[model samples]
Target: MTTPTVAVGALGGTIASTSSSADGSEVVPTLTAELLVAAVPGLDEVAAVRAETLARLPSPSLDEPTILRTLQWAQAAVDEGATGVVVTQGTDTLEEAAYLLDLFWDRPEPLVVTGAMRSPAAAGADGPANLLTAVRCAAAEGSRERGVLVAFDDEVHQARWVAKTDSMSTSAFRSPVFGPIGRCVEAEVVYGVPADRIPPLKLLPGHAGGDPRVPLLATYLGDDGFIVDSIRADDVDGLVVAGFGAGHVSASMAEAIGRLARQVPVVFASRTGSGPTGRAMYGYPGSEIDLVARGAVGAGWLSPVKARLLLWALSLGGPVPRADVAAAFELRGRP
Candidate 1:
């Protein structure tokens, strides 16, 4: 019933960038806690706002420990009476990071992640505006109902559905099939279709001291098992086959997946990135139908990176129980 206080946590990305002091030749990211606060003067008008500079790394440089620490800090902030938490991160791997947090987050408090497409070098860099709206969304009562989210381009997206669609556009973030779940309205938030809100971030580091490589191979119309077999014989730790629509694969490709499953685990994700994979979704001989029956895990509506990250964490050998890993997809009826 009390007024909510929102906290913004800054991780390095384009949001925290600046031009070179002397030459102005390069726009390097130099976003510190102080500078982020300086960029958003409206924080004083909203609920108690505190900005903490947790990391100064690029988005592509984001790793499990950093994400874990960010989740921990956000959880602590909400526990300290803040209504929610906002994270400013690099856009490179934001989708993957957000999905990781969504599956593992264990609380009900609002958690919004956002970033900018252009660095400080660009004229209309969208960092400050995005950060301000992320804070407002995190504090909005409607936001708490959606779990971990990404607030960008004036739109609120579920961490699960958001993917970067472009490199140079401010509209890089998008949810292709389902569209945005919410958006910012002045100082408030508005909801669209209700997102599958999950528990707060309760993640255990599944990739600590483990290999982070997730080689993805997609099967084409005339594809053979050549590429798949190569990855199996290489230094890769896991495999994510982006099968054709409905998760269908070629007979040779399905055989390759089965072979890789024997050496290391192989998971199948769809190139469509929407529906869950169905081994026999298309009745084709090489359809993912055979892959699932061969002990390969099927990613339900999760894109390749999310599937790869989940598999990477699983391969570390000390992750949550096997049944628990299997349970991660139980919501989609994984057998």
Candidate 2:
């Protein structure tokens, strides 16, 4: 069989980080994509690896333009005959990045995103293993048409459902809603379930001109909606509210949300981290039903962060129609 060509793009994270001091106190991203690929044992036997250093900053510092550029690079690589693509970045924002890519990645070739919770300098570092697995997934035919995937700890998760659940565990990433779609065993890729693929969002002309600001607000006990009230319609392109238990907020917060929905798009998601936001469950003044009645949209199953990214992507061209925004959520927020 012909060897599959996989392009690996490195965005500095724990996988590429090393100690800045001799004492090894602070770890910073210092390794390039070529260096990371070279360090992985038996990687050359799997596929022909092409490496490129897209950025040297931590995942938190990676901006939208950089991600968009990476997307463009991946598309170009596929066009130039690469079988698959892999991205390495920090776990802190890896889920969000993979989701954002999934929203617009139209190609059938798999684009796998992976990262390490532990730095390469640390004992039991998992970068090389994760990288190898991610490459294996990318090179596998089973990964085709899966949209974007997150490969971590031998488990393969769909980008839409994967989340960074733990702060400092090698097995931090998880697909809370549907579990992993696949896994790597003995250097072989096995897929248990196929992920549902939503239609990719098309960018409008001149999408690169400006940045859309979409803020995510999490509601808590005794919250009075002061923060929601403070946001003016002109201040942001969209708003995502992480409400309590299946999307409920205080009465004051609901009122503020209602007011904001009249001016700008508002989406409410669950703060519990899993499951879909209630569509017609409660009917109180501050319930999901009330919020939807007030012109706010429910983010059925998308996490708050992912909801924020969706809203931002929708608003990138300009003001998105309320119906269009709702339609997007209807497709993406479902299981």
Candidate 3:
């Protein structure tokens, strides 16, 4: 029997959107799977589209349970011989969940998460079009080998490389160092398989939102780092410092991070959130080069949460190779 194509849904972000046009100002989108599917055309022919309304929360409001629930639903789809999975979520924290799902799923099926900037009632609205394209990508046989992907604004990006740049631009999602896997046209989807870390993505026990154990602290000039003191005094298990560009923490923060790393893992991530976190990329008060030399683990492209997740996994004894996790955020050619 031929491997049939099917879809699994995890309602998020724009996919569950509603228009504010009727009420005048302050029209927040009220999203529903039924409404979103009706908006997209040609999805029926592509695969067996199924919807799971896991949450109606905004992307930034997405929590750990959101990640786990969506993953669970997708895993069931794959087990039942579904060829692909599509997730519709808000753009704000899309990468965070995408990276998390990519790490959690060991299955060899495509997981594509797509969301939109414009809502259904607005002119130049793009949600329906993006959703249709995502379904097509999920249905495409070629997508299976690519591991986890996030298809947005017609561009197919590998999960690990994509970042949401614009607040509300059609050209929002971009993979700076690497371009998209390919673009989805009306007729077809095209892309070559990339060299991604195969299954056995060491399982990492996730942390809930507002966990007093891990504090993500930022460092700036003349920064008192009272938060750091608070975190230390209260027994934070891990700390992620958004150091200066290129991953440098404040001098005082650096010293504090160094001490903290000895006690708990101190992950260095860039506030830039788009580039690799490494030394020698810039000259500043707290350059990453110094941090790495100080035994601080540099989170190459990982945003703070991603870096935290990876560390939490490693600390919990997940076998996801350190080098693989390192490669997740490192510069393209460097990886």
Per-candidate count of clashing residue pairs (backbone under 3 Å): 11, 0, 9
TM-scores, all candidates, are 0.86, 0.98, 0.84
Candidate achieving the largest lDDT? 2
lDDT of each: 0.75, 0.92, 0.69
Q: Which stretch of 10 consecutive residues in model 3 shows the poorest summed lDDT?
A: 203-212
Candidate 2 stretches with Cα past 4 Å from truth are none
lDDT of 3 at 290: 63
Is 1 or 2 the stronger prediction by TM-score? Answer: 2
The sequence of per-residue lDDT tens digits that candidate 3 reaches over residues 1-335 is: 44447564745575566654565334354766766786677777666677656677777788656686688788888898788888888888887788778767777778888888876666788888788888888887778767778888788887767788789797799876777988887648888555465453544444322223556777777765556655662365567887667677667776666665555656788777666677576544456766665556788766666677655544444233435444643532133
> lDDT score of model 3?
0.69
**What is the TM-score ranking, best to worst?**
2, 1, 3
Kindly report which residue stretches of model 3 are placed more than 4 angstroms away from their true locations once superposed: 1-4, 20-25, 192-195, 198-200, 204-212, 279-285, 315-334
Model 1, clash count?
A: 11
Task: Give model 2's TM-score versus the native structure.
Answer: 0.98
- The clash number for model 3 is 9
